[model samples]
Target: MSTANRDLALKKIELVPGKRVRQKSKLLQYIWFNRYLYLMLAPAVIYYLIFHYAPMYGAVVAFKDFSITKGILGSDWAGFKHFEYLFSQDKFWQVIQNTIIISVYRLIFGFPAPIIVALLLNEVRARLFKRTVQTVIYLPHFISWVILGGILINLLSTDNGVINNIIKAFGGTPIGFMSDETYFRGTLVFSMIWKEFGWNTIIYMAALAGIPPQLYEAAVIDGASRWQRLLHVTIPLIRSTIILILILRLGGIMEAGFEQIFVLYHPGVYSVADIIDTYVYRIGLTEGRFSIAAAVGLFKSAINFALLVLANRLARLMGEQGVY
Candidate 1:
């Protein structure tokens, strides 16, 4: 086309509506045209609506004197009585401290473990050996915490257990790992790493697979050693994936593995092992403090939401993609 004709065509395009408005109109048209496709999505939509969103109405009970006889709507308003009760209890602060400490320990030790494993696996040349290692490591993740808890109890037993037997062989006293408060938190952290590190590596391995081979080849040609290539080329490529996963981990700081703690913990280690979810279970179901438990749960959800938003904002500020 001639230059004048091209200029005229550009002018005509410029006279059209803004891109955002046009995009929305096109999306509506496409959705209407392929309404059957959306019909296929109805089951998932309905599932979330029914199971996830519909129950949110019960959250109002957190601010009420919730009674089995009185429905949520019919319950008398108690303002923040439950919340005030929760904040005043010393046990509540202890549970909060335990939760934060355990989460921080997991973030420190558990987070980098999978990344290290994935990097080492990437270096392995023997496919059979690599697959065998991966299979063995991943097996623990599929085992339920209830079963694993029993296994741990047996293994860490002070009498006639494998670890205690070894300790006796070395002339050291048998340690009550599960029962003693001193060792209980360490046991929790180690158990978590053993159970979930392999499963977590799957994500890092996938990210590693997407790193271009050309970068490694170029690094090699530039006289980079194996370690140099890994440090300079591989790490930088997966940096964004690491940052994204870290942000997600931060958002879950309030939830410190309820099932594992519940299964492994006893009255002996309650000082170190009690956390928010376990406390909620004890107060809500066992003690029948429904309103107080609901208030605590609501507080937990609010904190999680705030952390998620803060992490997303930080990611954007650091020039990475946010979850939003």
Candidate 2:
């Protein structure tokens, strides 16, 4: 309000580093205080830089007529030729359809499962039973898809599997779940949820723990039922986390589980399960259509990048936190 005070404030503003310098200093201080944690994260950062980022340079093959001996740098550039080839194929649309359908199924069924489980677990009074149930559910997540796919094949095998045994006892024919295009995608999605929901619940459970206990106590005092408390208080508290995870999950829409699909699929179900990654593998390694495979890979990455950016923007617009 006074001239001297206004001049003093202006001088302080002039002395203050641009926003970037102050932010960098703050980040540096935080990092200094958490040096050990940063050191632990270094391996993952390096892994991504080497395996994920460095290989991005080879994306140029999407425009090149790649040759084995020529390598990426020496490959002859043929701009958009592979992309044209990809777009001309009927299987391209089929792959896109399968990818979208499977991802949508996962999002619809898999997303809310952990939240529901976490909410139920949060309300449990008995710690021993809780621990046992959590352990049982989470154990499957550690198993590789290779082993899981094998177990699925055995379970769904038409000859003498457990599911078929039940079908026979009921006077019905046993279906080859893995081989049926109609059933294969559904089976994979459900199995993925079964194997993953428990591990995913760990994050939701941790978020649930951070919600203030006083809210639940207040809800009880207000004569709210258990379900009412969960719906009104618990869900609201963890809504941001749910939104964040949903955005991140949607960003991977182009990437249906490669390992699971590859192992579970046969020629019979290839129409439904042949996703971008497996297609790339067949072309690049098996067929030696290196440039075409690289093109497909690049296309997949572009779509994923677009989705990530769009989701991040939508998340911000909706007042939710994003991975950025």
Candidate 3:
């Protein structure tokens, strides 16, 4: 090469390194400026790393014939044997079906409950009355299902329960809400809605509050009625929030409330109430089938991840921004 060309090549290489160093310094400076904000986020990041992501390492047991004495790494590799065992069982299918049914019921019924409550609250003219209503509904969320379970038992028991006595007063037959198979699933769905719907409304309430007042003014000047304003102005603004929450909720479809179900359900209702989480509790902790339990837990996680991805893709296809 000519001396001029060699000199130009060296200059280009020097410029490239100088440009990269400037970019790196700018990134560090940006992070340093935002250090306090990141400091606030550190605890949450640490928590997921410690409690959620750290335990993921133990998922190796799903592929192992795990023994407490042998430990995770020392155990013999089973090579999908545990999953094959799970697939071969009829009870596995039953449990999966029960889980999907209960979750879908909640998705259909419970998902709309919060939105409806938020809308009603939005319409209320009396601040005092609306605040009281919100407090009354939100109280149940603070109480654990253990306390609520005892309360429900007294209220819904088939034999001389509070509700049953009221029914008998009206010359009606008592319903077996807790013990019978027919009513147990309904009871589960209803109780979940009653427990969670109020708490869930907080998000929708915030979404409603964020709507620009000018848009409502424009709608009113356009001669839109209150109902028309809600349909045309309110719902459209909150659609993205609804889609975001729904996508996140779909990721937990397999979790059918082990604490609630275990507290209320008995063998009579097992056909309908037995779900993946409860089954994991029974087979893993109660029965000490470590490998099988690990297999079930891992499988549940895979399904949840797939659903989250699918929901995000569908949301994007509908021309909305979804969590990626």
Best by lDDT: 3
Q: Give the per-residue lDDT of model 3 (tens digit) for 75-129.
A: 9999999999999999999999999999999899999999999999998989999
Superposed by TM-score, candidate 3 places the C-alpha of residue 37 at a distance from the truth, in angstroms, of 1.0
lDDT of each: 0.93, 0.88, 0.94
Deviation of model 2 at 201, angstroms: 0.6
Q: Select the stronger candidate by lDDT from 2 and 3.
A: 3
Give the per-residue Cα lDDT of candidate 3 at 70. 90
Which lDDT tens digits does candidate 2 get at residues 196-216?
999999999999999998998
Q: What's the TM-score of each model vs. the native?
A: 0.89, 0.90, 0.96
Q: Per-residue lDDT for 61-158 in model 1, tens only?
A: 89999988988888999999988888999999999999989999999999999999999999999999999999999999999999999899889988
Error of 3 at 247 (Å): 0.5
Best by TM-score: 3
Show model 2 residue runs off by greater than 4 Å.
Answer: 1-34
Which of the predicted structures, 1 or 2, would earn the higher lDDT when compared with the native? 1
Model 1 root mean square deviation, Cα atoms: 5.7
TM-score rank order: 3, 2, 1
Cα displacement (angstroms), candidate 2, residue 142, comes to 0.9
